[model samples]
Target: MKNVLNDPVVNVKGIGEKLEQGLNSLGIYTVEDLLFYFPARYDVYEIKPLSELIHDDKVTIEGKVSSEPSLTFYGKRKSRLSFNLQVEHVTVKAVMFNRAFAKKQLQVGDMVTLTGKWDQHRLQITVSNYQKGRAKSDAKIQPIYALKSDVSNIQIKKAVTTALSQYQDDLQEILPEEYLSAYKLPGRLEAVKHMHFPDNHQVLKHARRRFTYEEFLLFQLKMQLLRKRKRESTFGNSQDYQAKDVEKFVEALPFQLTAAQSRSLNEVMTDMRSPYRMNRLLQGDVGSGKTAVAAIALYATITAGKQGALMVPTEILAEQHFQSLQELFADKASVVLLTGSVKGKRRKQVLQEIADKQADIIIGTHALIQEEVVFQDLGLVIVDEQHRFGVEQRRVLRDKGLHPDVLFMTATPIPRTLAITAFGDMDVSVIDEMPSGRKQVETYWVKENMLDRVLQFIQKEVDNGHQAYVVCPLIEESDKLDIQNAVELYQQLQEIYAPKTAVGLMHGRLPADEKEEVMRKFAANDIQVLVSTTVVEVGVNVPNASVMVIYDAERFGLSQLHQLRGRVGRGDAQSYCILVADPKGEVGKERMKIMTETTNGFELSEEDLKLRGPGDFFGKKQSGMPEFRVADMVHDYRALETARTDAQQILASGALDENPVFQKLAQYVYNDKIVKGETLD
Candidate 1:
């Protein structure tokens, strides 16, 4: 029988029923998962004595309790346990919150080590988990595991220790030994063990470097495979068409296309006309002519006796795209809108038309991917805000056509290093320049006390027949915050500006129809002041909306703030984005400074990445992206570069198809579970 340490969590001793349930809540169903649970930080408990510690010093101290412990309870709910410790003749107070057990364990003259900052007001040692040890003269770091509410760091550390002792020999190195040595990466098992419990700061850094590179390499390998698959598949109806019709469509537009837009359209058209299908990304800042470029592609398809589909992130965006496409392609082709809201006969008929090739241009949200929806000859598939959809959704849409040429679009500018690392397979085309006559929106930062003046500015803009968007950071009340809720803010704004203008509220919590209704009213100018959350960040396109008031602007990422600002300045009218910051600290002020300094989405995105690091998930504020604990995208750009270079070199060598090692690495990255089934074939 396998030892308890080598078996799964279910087989662990003393974790039979109740404890197993507690462990399950912490996502530790398997012993392997528990082993992979890494630390978030470490409280180094090795420091000099209190006498050696100076004023305003942050250090760890080891000493023995010299005085009787004191227990004090204030305000019924608040209780503090304190004791005096003698560290080289300098007495320091050890404090803990609601820790009654500490009073018994830490007797007078008992040895204890305390770690924290020391100040004039009571040698404050916030007692970081007392342990009996001599103070280390050398600097040391300890592992601090990220724990679920129910699971403590000690529990995870103990499990990790057990797993490391048992499974140290079982972990086979998946990467080639030569590659590992060349890159100076740790052994797979060694890295995993150190990641969970590092002995020193250098070991932790090295372990992190190894793990991050592994992640990037694995991700790149999978993307390369997918790219190969896409290229091999014969998709996209390469229908023949005249450039004259595309020119006519461009001519009919009220505004001329920017040079960047024209260049991107040319590249897309060249791809569309090619025998191989196009899978390109149309990335641009807000107010750039990407939409117009997309129109050109759709019209080119229609002229060539093929169909085109535009999948947007939200229903409001879908409706807006449908309306704009219809107006632009009224004389040339038939355009249809299909969303979940379209019911009964209308939905069925639209689906039929899509499948039958009667609809030349189809615009909708995720409803376009319904199994019933088909394209007669889907020549092109444009996914606006492409990151909003998962990889599977992109595949599903690709499967809909022979291999519809995909044009993924995003307004959120990403850093160049991340773009190359994250989007290695897909060909990228950037529309970096905005159209002429688009006056850059003037940005300002104001404190909460100056909100009234900002409101007055918004009212002035509204009075000029332009609309305004008021963005709130919170949708509802939370126990941790005293910030204003969106609903409350909407009501307050309605009361304040009621007689002069109509107020509309839109948020993710509202039913789709209600949100759409509010958005439609605002877009139509029936509601002059639209109060909303970040729900309006990507969904709506109202050129008439000229002013944006972002409440608690400091709460947002710089990239997100740029996106919110993009909501305005859509029309020719001059626009303004007022960032109202909390007066708490320089954090808010610094964020506002970044916003006021630039309007470049790419620059702002780099700054955002520099500030908050990498996010696991993104799209609408409603979507929750998974957070990666150890990986830092901005700081770890070197790792990304290393992985990309190695992947490219390997691919360039053309060994993946023939070499056994690459076959194993491919399977390792793709299946992730295939490692167990490995056998000498």
Candidate 2:
């Protein structure tokens, strides 16, 4: 069994070099991988009489070929094999597309089983799969695996069968033996075999339940351990702030805090004052006043005679937060910005203030996480756009203090399912509603043919003494994706609005200082129009930029489109977001409709998560989310809760340390290295 697990997938028959590469693409490396690579779904074939078949019903029917199969070559690599099959003494027309090889297997009197959609009106069957002779008993339930262009599902099924047959008897069980018996789960090898080749629906369901519980248990064990450790490990100072003091400060604010903001702020304060270290996620939409709640928490932390740090994704955002805090706490706390750009003697002074506990509130970029920047008595840490920073980066900043209360803030409203799985160890607080009297951005979907009109509208907005932003999907043209790129669109817009009003260009490829310079120019309205990519998606407040035109908007997800739209409507003046694209598919059209209909970021995020499946999930940087192969955080949430309870009980029972099987499991969990609330704020 050990050798089988270590041996390469090529040990299985028919998995040649090319198929090996395909399996590698799917992250399948060894024969053991083949055994564990379960099917995405199964097509259960129930043989039915032809007379009882309904319209478009997919089923298997036993029949004899009454006529010789005639093959016809159609347009461009297309072929159709048509034959008359006598099923239950009735002749039915059966046609198979692209499976020209079926013609060679069919004879006048040969019996076969065909599974396909039966078109009642056409009195014909569209066969998807067929067996030359009577269908094998085990073939009633066929495993269908996700495939790449290089390999087919049939090929993968055969390989999995070979590996399972070779190592079924010797497969090792990872879950504790008591768990198997208590949960009424099959043995590890039996479960794996059932997952790969389910004999019946009941067995398949049991197999799936076993794996789902297995994954959720592992994930929840890690989360529960983190939670347990946090509760037990108390801070020496044990963050303290008077409730009345926080409430009085809130009352003294110049502007009224939104109800949502107020509620989230209270939640943060409660967590901060708790005996255990606070690990929490603060979620709000773009322009939802998350900064206010964060500022209030920072106030409470500082008032408690401890330092507070606010870290953001970009230097501009850090500067913005720094300015806000500086203004809000003008006569209250000493605020300082310690970005990478703050250099020489000034940087030294900032470091001195931080070390000497003079800077009550220090805001900066990733520079705050540097080894030299030490917090005198850091009690509360607020990380804005938490998804931007990595796990180790956040850990470094938190480690600077003696188990400080960490509050993660994000303008991007993460889908609830993602939030649960991604930050299972942390408590979540959401600011769903925007502040009252905030102007909503009026979104419009403009087709490709209406480009001139959209450009004219932007030109009109610019003429009316307002700046505009044009965002593209790509920075440059690519051979693979033929879309409107930032540089090309910039050049075109520059040519159109040039010599009169300046049109500046910016993208991710630009240097940090150069990008900052362009942004500053655009923010100051020195540049009437700024053409850029989604680099401007994050918090780069430009209230003066009233018009946002997104090219190829359909190429982006709903959440992204909403974020970009948020750039406008920050000021009081009416704002507009014009999406310029033509989507051919219904999903893309629905996305466009959602955008044009509403400006709620959270609603759009849920829709976006549903639309983009596990393939794209959220985005490229979302690797921090739990990568469960079988368990779904969305659909299997109840199972996840059960697993969490079971994990907590097991931990409390000391099984991880006392039981031999659990000892091995503990080692495996440690190797998995599931960190606490790193991303998905």
Candidate 3:
């Protein structure tokens, strides 16, 4: 019967071909998938009398029908059924729009239970679901599932109930008995049963806790195993770090290195010289000199007779890095850039140089991972804005060499808890200090009514020989979203600041060449103002751009807002970031206030995680993180810590080899990694 869990959803009792197709649309193909598809919310049907119902409150009420249901027609196509109900000494009106079936079951003096929201202005209860008569027992909590097209919550509930009844006895416990005792968790079968149909809120909470812990434990176990494999693997290149050479490189720089930058570089240097392969994450705020630290590491690798590769998210960033590296390594190493746009003779020449070991330092976008882009004795791989690349993409580049030391860098600072949970297997280095002469960008929150004032400030900043960026949430006008868009705003700004200031437009919809051109013009100060979307959030660096005005700023996450604000304040002049939005909700207002209060990326990241959870903080795809079924990086942080420790203990004790359940869990994680194109031996 254990095999029943893997049976297709079509084998379920109530799910037919049509229903199975709908379920497939929701990513539920197997019985196990159906069982794990937990309810998004529960509708508690606590019976209440009519007199206890409040205006605009959703409640379930039991009452006796006081009048016959009457059907009312608003127009030819619209009609509603209305009736009166009496509960104890109170009378209330009940209405069901387009529910003709409800009219037939209801009659005068018949007792019924209905669930809906009460409207005080209309003095009516708009019923969504109703029972023909009061139940013999108390009302039970109902599960409201997330659905796809043509699939109803009722259908999902029925299918899930059938699956639970048939497979409950066969459900195997994945957690070890000792772990269950230590954590005081319920068995797998009981947790799944209770999660779908809990007898009480306490049971539901226990079930949720068990599943969340399981997810975190499995993830931690996988991460620990990966770390073990990397440490024991003998394929990595071990390079020597010459302190004098690194010092010479640093001293020759145009500006002094910040303390934080020095510390991060030292960490990287130490990792490079270590026997074990280095898998490190370098995090810093925007403009925190992460590039300079990475440059030093690349220099060290090249100087050691090993080639290095740096992968960026966009071509514009790749070109920028290429130019910067060329200037930085003017007399030192051969530098080359390879992008999709570099074609024919140029592309072939670059590839030949790389394959021939002539190009010591290589920088490019996704084109770096193509088959033709081979490396000669590649020893170091630095992934800029690491979150932009998937785990498999990173693996592909690393596989180009015999286990090259990998360094992942990101400007989006993650919360400490998330960093531990998400990247627990990798070493972390943070550049928390800004370089000297860099001033914090002054930020302000303004309503839409202050648009003119914001525009005036942008104009004034441009007049002062500084550039400005006007960011919108959308590229084109969206009928569904009323936020300001780049296309329309570009036109408006051109008309408003035109003749006086040069305005440029950029968005993701633009072609690669066009985007590069616009950014080039903006950087060269040919365009005084650039109206664009969040594409500039990552790696478009213009030191002279001092003013950033983000329209519909409330639509962005705090971390994102911080990144956008980072585009400015890169030069010697004082900068300003104006958030033009009238956030109506408390959360949005709070997000706006946080942006105005601080420039610390880590603090803002923590707040963003708390406010929006890990999913919203960064898309799972963008972050290259696995989507957890039950565990949340923010809320289940305690569970994550315990799981990490227990996973380590289990692996260290060699108990995982003897446990079939642990083996199965490992297999599942491995399969997921394989699906994502991650390398596993």
Candidate 4:
């Protein structure tokens, strides 16, 4: 049985090479994998007499076949097997379409059990499934699994049944018996069996809860272990907190720091001073002073005789940060920008200064992590728009220094549940409070036909000496159509307000220098109307830009639309975000309505998570969220919290190292973390 569990799925009785390949598409490779392939849902049917069946009531009825089943044609291509089923004094018509074979299987006076929906209007049972026996007294809950096109639920259920019958006893229990009893959870074997074929809803619920807890527990344990490994490692460089320097920097700022900003800065300061490296996530809403908070941390790093590198996702943002930091530092610390556009002697000079520690603050895009660009005494690394970069890229920058204090900044406000699960390894500080004088961007959901009105409104705003942005969705990978869309929109806007206002165009297809130039024009108000794609979703800050017209807003996620809207409302001017979308579905309309109703990013994020699920909420490509087999971050938040607490308790009890079962489980989780490049040691 143990060997059978470990064998390839093709070794199962009915699963041949072709069927095994089909199962493999669903991530089933071995017998053990097949055994754990949980069902997406269940079809529960109760055994009932024909007389008790009503319209749309799914049930199983056992009776004698009073009439011989006959195959008959209805339409040009439709055929069905018809017969009369009798239960005492009640007789019901039974119909099975496209089932000529059933005619040969069943005869008059034969006993049969038919499972289907009862249509009272027709006084018939539309047979979905059948068997040659009396219906069981107990209700049958059949597991319905998600499968590939060629693989049916019946095929998977049969395979699982065979595998379970042979090797259910060999399934190892990862959770200790003590904890199982303490949690009042069933054993692994019993849970697996009941999960696939439960006797009742109660058993099914218990099985689901047990497995959900296991999934969440394993993830939480992995994160905790990773955190523990990092804490124990002595490779980090300890830095002086430099409270005086931080205070001096804050005093130099033009505006006052909000309470949330100050608290977040204090958190960063404390983390930097610790012996262990600072791995923190700084989450703040759009227009929040996260940049200012990061600037303070960088100031402290420079004051402590260390170089600070701020990595943004775009060249325009890097330049913006460079200019802002340069002015803020004002000859106190030498700050330089190193982007792909900075070339020849200029690039070499910047690189030399950075490497020689002459440049106290260096701001750049992905160019900062290149082989040639080196940092001297790099103590602090601030990653703006952290989700844009991959884990390896972030790691490479962190490795530039010996245990650099990494502070990741995201303008996208994450729900608490997501923050805990997705970024469990890092310490998090949220600047939930926006700085004073920041105005909430007024949002409106407009139909596509209202484009002219929106454009006119934008023109009026531009005429009032305020800038505006027109954002379009990326339609194609080649970007031929997307670029053309932006270009066409730019021309259209130019023609509409041509002699009165200047317009610029930007897209992913443009060169780095051109993109920077366009953004520069927009910032300087040289371009009153800038037509672009999601490229302006982050870091193109212009206080004068008071209006944002998002074309095809239905194509964007709520968080993304929020981020684009964030590009505006930086100034005290009453900003407007006009969403011009003709959504085709309820979800999309609901997203638009939510945006129109509120300007709170956190609230919008919660709604987004519920509406779009986690995959689309954070963007599946770069969200870096763990793929859970059973645990859902949104719906199963309670389970996640419980699992987290239990994991901590288990770790504190030293059971992970003392018990062989827990040790194996920890090892498995650790190995999985390694695969994701999340291991600390």
lDDT of 2 by residue, 1-681 (tens): 134575888877777899899998888998877787888777877776667888987878888999999999989999999999988877889999998887887889999989899888887989987887887766558788987768888788888887777766657777888888888888778788888877788988888888898898888788777766666666453667866877888898888988898788878888888777788889988888888898889999987889998988778878887887788888889999999889999999999999999899999887887998888888888887744556687567556545688888877788776776777777889999988888889999988899999889998898988989999999888999889999888889888988988999988899999998898788788999999899888747888889999999989988888888988988878999999989988999999999998888888887887787533545655765767778877677778877878888888999887888787577656555444334322
Can you list the residue pairs that collide in candidate 1?
235-403, 236-403, 617-625
lDDT of 1 by residue, 534-584 (tens): 888877889999999998887888988999999999888999999888746
Better of 1 and 3 by lDDT: 3
TM-scores across all candidates?
Answer: 0.80, 0.80, 0.85, 0.85
Candidate 4 achieves a global lDDT of 0.83
Candidate 4, number of clashes: 0
Q: Give me candidate 3's TM-score against the actual structure.
A: 0.85
Question: Which 10-residue window in model 3 sums to the lowest lDDT?
Answer: 672-681
Indicate which candidate wins on TM-score.
3
Better of 2 and 4 by TM-score: 4
TM-score attained by model 1 = 0.80
lDDT (Cα, 0-100) at 93 in candidate 4: 93
* Candidate 2 residue runs with Cα over 4 Å from true position: 1-35, 43-139, 144-193, 230-234, 394-402, 614-617, 645-681
- Evaluate model 3: give its lDDT: 0.85
| Deviation from native of the Cα of residue 431 in model 2, angstroms | 1.3
State which candidate has the highest lDDT. Answer: 3
Q: Which segments of candidate 4 are over 4 A away from where they belong?
A: 1-7, 10-22, 46-97, 100-139, 149-151, 386-391, 394-401, 474-488, 621-623, 659-664, 670-681
Clashing pairs in 3: none
The lDDT ranking, best first, is 3, 4, 2, 1
